[model samples]
Target: MRGMTNTLTIGERVAWYRRRRGMSQDVLAGLVGRTVDWLSKVENDRIELDRLSVIKNLADALDVALGDLIAEPSLMEWVADSGTKTIPRLSAALMDYRLITPVSSPSPIAEMPSLVSLAQEVDELWQAYQASRFGYVTTLLPETLSRCQTAVEAYDSDDQVQARRLLAFTYQLAATQMTKIGEVELAWIAADRGLAAARITGDPVAIGSLLRSVAHALLAAGRFREAMQLIQDTASYLDPHLSDPSPELLAVHGTLFLTGSMAAARANDTDTTRTFLKAADESAQRIGQDANHVWTAFGPTNVAIHRVATAGELGNVQVAMDLGPRIDTSALPMERRVRHALEVARAYSSWNRTDDALSTLLAAERIGPEQVRYHFLSRQLVLTWIKRQKGRPSSTLADLAHRLKVLD
Candidate 1:
């Protein structure tokens, strides 16, 4: 009991100094002179920590009273009040009603599902991670992944195409989460299956959507032209007259992923970009512009997040950042939230804002090790920008190359 108590106490102490310093794991590691990987292992209870001297150094660095390091309830408990605080926005039709909308559910958890319910099993998995329930999260992934796999297989045999499409989407969700948590190979395998199902089911939106992610995977490997080509193919494949897709489908394809082609356009035709944008907006309007499914139902906010960074390629960073948060992620079904978070991370990183870049990546990373792919994306942009800024090779860029075990 005492050992358990000590572990809790020490964890609390570690978490406190880290936060008080306003230091990310990487920054703290640099200060106290430890690798970020080691820092992560220590803080996450994956290692036996024995570096009180490091704490003293951190105390001096962050300008905190050293005594505060030993404060109780563990530092993790105060994260909400710590750096992740939500700054409430003023009301406007452009904002999420939830952002401006009063909290009608007195207890936030009132809407939450039990950890075992299928309807919200994906959320439960994410919740486990949010609560620092790493072991629980790990234990649950196989079950969730397996259950989703079984569902996909059953759909394969069943006559219901929509059920198959939904299950295939579920598989894609599981794969993307797995990728964020550092499950790259597994994620690729699952994603391939999901893509196959989308193809077999003839969901054009799903096909284009998978192609979009395929482009991301390619982009991360620095296969820029390949990624561009895939986007081109995807854009070529779309048929405006096609119907039955949710509003979110239009947003993702005609807007979100379509921006990739715009990025590679490089002054070919501003008029074409405008035309594509109009098509996306028109496609979204067909669905009433409601911000459901994480405001991805082709609403203004989702459109902003979708267009912002790519627009930045054409000098629209101010508009992108200003309009980004208005995206009502809360309205999204939980399965989609994880995916959106990864994209949000990418959007922020592309603007040369390292702090926002890291924050966005960490939001996805906090969820698990399988998300290395996103780290690749963010670090690529960040490293490139940093190198260009220095007029010398960035050591930080070199550091990420080492992490990726790739030499560029």
Candidate 2:
């Protein structure tokens, strides 16, 4: 009777085990001789799991014992507060990696869209990312990536050069989205591919932008020293162009410096952090206060936001708090605004201001519920706050935890 009452639905257990093994539905479907769409339906409870043989096959494909699928851990908590679509969609997008290959010969120009059209499509993808419409981005990325890759390989003349630039930026957008969802290895691969495309284009500015994307993935993967070395190596080439840099070049350069500053802060190199932050400040001042570049939001206000983040990472809670209110985040995108609020929440947590931390986190949630609900840091903060409460938590906190799925 206990087992009957406690058993996880086949869909829930299947999804949990699949994610635990880091296998996408595409991969699992191939292993089990099924279509991804079919597997998705099963995982979403659209179909019954009544066939014992099929269940066994799924267990084998997932490399888990069949019994494991019948019963999940009773104590397993922290189910995602948001819809289950995000990670699965990301995984599906990454499956397109196998389709990308080097183009050996150019296709006829008449068969492909113009270079300007391809570039505009890539820019539209970037806009989707900036607006934090990740679901729509997921829908766009596979076709965009395929189209860009084809354009790059198909053009034979000066148009080919521009096509390569567009392709490189498309890959950078993929890397950015991958990194946002904590898929660092996939992000690294995308960034490296973008760098290769940029190098082929022979554009220093594009190469610099791809390098910053690579550095971001490295930092996310906890390779701080490697990330710092990358920034150092690439900065030398790009720094010379600063004298009369285009706004594009300045945005990339400023973003690189800001990334380097954050990496240094994470590595506990305070002096290096300060040096990079100051350099970034100079670049931001030159560029002024706007998200002028389509690919990056690295202007004065954005730089100020990173300074607060850097201070927080360095364990300077009071200092971060002091600087937080001075920076106006209105010019930034929704993603940046939510991140700044989360950083301030982190500082509040560090200072043992539990109520302040909760308030800040709630504000961030209101600003971007999808981001807060899916972010690992937000989950950890809510869990920690709940554990630290004395006796019964306030009704608001209790309701918040339940909504966040930090408590069942």
Candidate 3:
């Protein structure tokens, strides 16, 4: 501490600003509407803070002020905010670099990134997720969600209906991905938030989409009755009498009923399953020609995956296996495409085809460590069956079971 009021280098100032806001470089990027790499450079004094709007956005996102952000705060502030305080040895250098920036020569500025439109950024993130590039997905998704949430908070002030809709939809997307990792509770929370926001906007399409999300969470949690009720209620809300009801809206609602039916079958309530399926099929027909509506759930591929799960549950392994090969993998994102292999594993295991089952399971595991979920349940099922057949499973399967942490 020795210049002006105290000595703080460029790195020091950047680090201080980060601390002042109690943000990590990643979180700072989220606040400032920049990428992590860019924020890191800025903190290292390798980049300049050129965007006033971004700086203001950062303050808003961090719930802080621009001047306080310039104070000589310590990295401890960030640690405190992160709900932890032990400074990692690796992080020891950020402080030193911080103290050095004000007293030493400034680090050279990095080349600025080309500005991309918000939709373009979203498109890029979606593409990365589609590729199953988990590193990129996890890295950017938080920031994207932050931006969407921030936009949602400000949507009313801007008087933009479309922007509000986008914000609500983005939350639904976050909830869907959260459920992939078995965070069903959080996913449901997000869906509820989105539902409230959609209702505020009086957007039937948005509300229907959020309802489908809630339906997915309920269906997966084995709440068949509740899921059915939700779908039925959503149908009533949609008011099919609209002169040009969106095919996208109808398709999603139809898919919700299909999900409930599948859940019902899993519960062994065949009558309920049949009833829901009949309603779903009827609604599916009302969703006419537009196959690419982001909300429409109509592709033959979507139908195939649901068919496999339902048939497998109904003890019709042959039907599931038969439909498995007909699914169009090219039409789905990696997250859902990887689910096809899960269905394959189930169908093979059901037929007592040990080798085929193992192969499918291993293949799915190889491609989808970070992309898919619920493998532990499948592994447990196979291992239990194996143990029942013999005193123990094969050594190889036993080892696999251990790796998967299953009862087998």
Candidate 4:
């Protein structure tokens, strides 16, 4: 096992570890709450092992750290090649400010840009973020944050209000990017700052937006109950405007419901998930399809995509796959489309259609390489696929694994 660790798939590693511990497949399976046949498939690399919870359970049953099972040199190489430094830098920035201190002291009053220019810049940054141009966002965030701080300090009261609003939205963008890169703590800080600034601006919509961002961070951190409560409370507070909903109101409202549904799904609360999803669907119906209001992209098509995602999350693979055919990827933005495809790939993997899953993932990569390459789950899928091959993997799969840094 030690000699072949570099070449062995995850299933082989699991079997090796179990055998080294002198445990039969039946014994290990019982400890992990799985049947022997399931264990055999996993050991033979006939099935993909992608779920973190399942991995953790296996690690515990095998008396190993979770990282001991997952850490691989190839994956490290991929991370290095990915150039994903934004999350760490953002985390450092958040730690520097403690989510309380301003980003920086003001420049001289004369050096500050006018509120109009600042607002325009903010719009550009917002557009970049919504377009999923994360590298561009990383390039712009430091200067934009500094400028926003300077404006917040330099402006008079009336103008300062708008300046703070710009600052808040800028921080919200930071939060969104940080979350995408798996920097949950940094994302939380940025979202909190956005909420603070939004409150100062007295804009209910901005507040709602920041709340949604914070809830996202919470969800990523696995605080599903807290996330659900936060979103539900905020949604109720903002419900008054639903009767005469502006696009912004509808977007936020729909997004909040969507977030609530996700949190509930994570908690295995089917009733709550159904209720929130129903409300979101109704909101989407009213808004029609493909609306990118506030970059939430809350509309009928987006709702359909989430339905598939929610079903997948709840372990209803068939339901997720059944709903997948109804989704119109053409109506989604590039980022959303990539995500939908990846979710379908996950469903295929769950259904033991490894070839279909790999094809789906590769297709998504072709459509948006950055989106696919930088995603954490993509590496897992690639590694699992590599392990499942009985002999020499096809050149196509091997080449992708090498490109993705999951194979030597």
lDDT (10s digit) by residue, model 4, range 289-357: 668887787888777888887887778899987888557787667788888888898888888887888
Candidate 1 lDDT (Cα, 0 to 1): 0.47
Instruction: Give the higher-lDDT candidate: 1 or 2.
Output: 2
lDDT of each: 0.47, 0.73, 0.56, 0.76
Model 2 scores a C-alpha lDDT of 0.73
Cand. 3 Cα-lDDT: 0.56
Q: Which pairs clash (backbone N, Cα, C closer than 3 Å) in model 4?
A: none
Report how far residue 343 has shifted in candidate 2, in Å: 0.6
Local accuracy of candidate 1 as per-residue lDDT tens digits, 348-374: 654556567556655654453233332
Give me the candidate number with maximum lDDT. 4
lDDT of 2 by residue, 45-72 (tens): 5554433345656877777654455432
Is candidate 1 or 3 superior in lDDT? Answer: 3
Q: Model 3 Cα displacement at 157 (Å)? A: 7.2
RMSD of each: 18.0, 12.8, 20.1, 4.7
Greater-lDDT candidate between 1 and 4: 4
Q: In terms of TM-score, which candidate is strongest?
A: 4
Clashes of each: 16, 0, 6, 0
Off-target runs (Cα >4 Å) in candidate 3 are 1-116, 122-139, 153-159, 241-243, 282-292, 295-297, 325-330, 372-374, 385-408
